[model samples]
Target: MSNYSTTTLVMTRVFNVSREKVFDAWLNPKMMKKWLFTLEGTNKVAQNDPQVGGTWEIVDHRDGKDYRAIGEYLEIDPPKKLVLTFKMPQFSDTVDTITVQLKELEQGCEMTFTQDIIVPHEETWTEADIEKALGEYHDGSEHGWNLMFMGLKELVETGQISYKG
Candidate 1:
């Protein structure tokens, strides 16, 4: 049996907007800042050459510390799908690809995001730490994604960016 494990997080949101507009929001920095990592009143995101092999970074400042993450794009298909690598500084070198898809419904547009991660060595985590970390990550995943979706909705509906959380 394999000793590796993978974690998959899927989130879906319905926005009252077009797929193209939704897609552009992610690709655009002005739109991204309105939601991306805006929690706790501190965050930053920057993307360079946001295509395949393109670079991206987000610097989060909080509690008198700076946590930085950098990555690159693996695939890009406008108004449909996007795949990108994600990496955090000082952590193990793990490549994560975020797959985002856009679908149109009578009510609005449906945006689905799936993040898949392969943890090479689960033993590196103690049982207690593993449990705590997993719980925290799961909770953050839900909260963070919801925030992003709400931001998107606000922008599309009001022609202005707003964050309720």
Candidate 2:
């Protein structure tokens, strides 16, 4: 066994738009800043390169603080799947991988989003400890992603960026 255990955050959302549009928004600079990891009125600097091995960074400036998210494209299958490394240096040095999968539906598209949360597998870490941490992460992360998804859904369907986040 490795020295780490993975806790995956799996969530799905449906959008009233094409998967291509949803996928494009992830790469588009202007569209990204409107939603990706941001608060309703917070400003962010987004730098993204969508090609495989390319890196991305989004720094959110809120309440006189800069919260940064850095990642690299590990795999990209446009309109269908994307895999990237997600890291918030200020929070942790642990680099996690996030995978997004999209499938076309009659109404629109469904996005299956997931993030791999790696926990140290030290002998001292009891099962209870891991569960407790996961509980906290699940609530915070799920809430944040829901807000972002709302923003994305609105942006793509209405051609307007409302900071639902």
Candidate 3:
């Protein structure tokens, strides 16, 4: 087994909304569930209170398989910033830090989502393994972030929650 250290993934989106509106979505649990899971086959997902030290869990099914993600909230800020702990089941027990930053732009708000983690120094993931993991991650994150920003825009413009099923 070869050692594995830090792995980081960064994604950015420009949403036609204000920074305040965009930040509120991450601080609210009900708003988060709307766009957090964008996979094609995901089922029900539930999130508890979204505050510092809060816990959350999600159950997703795809291709006749079930997977769960359980984690805790590490930091919370209103309408500006957020940080959370992420975990994946039946895989490496890696600890991840996710940060969402909102920047004001002439057109709208620019949001950046970054996920960083450090695996065991002695662990190794083959090229195929890395590719598979990243594929799933990209699918989930892109969909999740897009949906989240959508919900944020709706809430700010419509004054109602339209993302809920």
lDDT of each: 0.71, 0.84, 0.67
Model 3: per-residue Cα lDDT over 1-165, one tens digit each: 245455676878777778887786665555555445423235467566677999877666766766677778888776667788777766768767888888889977888888875455423677667666666665665666566556556665565555344
Model 3 TM-score (2 dp): 0.66
Q: Candidate 1 lDDT, tens digit per residue, 73-99?
A: 888899898888766756656666678
Worst 10 residues of 2 by lDDT: 36-45
Model 2 C-alpha lDDT per residue in residues 32-127, reported as the tens digit of each score: 888888643575688888899999988888778999999999999998999999989997777889999999999899999999876655577888
Mark the regions of model 1 whose C-alpha exceeds 4 Å error after superposition: 1-4, 39-45, 90-92, 119-136
Q: In model 2, how large is the Cα lDDT of residue 22? A: 95
- Number of the predicted model whose TM-score against the real structure is largest: 2
TM-score of each: 0.77, 0.89, 0.66
Worst window of 10 by summed lDDT in candidate 3? 34-43
Residue 155, candidate 1: Cα error in Å is 2.6
* Window of ten residues with lowest summed lDDT in model 1: 38-47
The residue-level lDDT of candidate 3 at 20 comes to: 81
lDDT of 1: 0.71
Q: Which scores better on TM-score, 1 or 2?
A: 2
Q: Once superposed on the true structure, which residue ranges of model 2 sit more than 4 Å away at CA? A: 1-4, 39-41, 120-125
lDDT of 2 at 26: 87
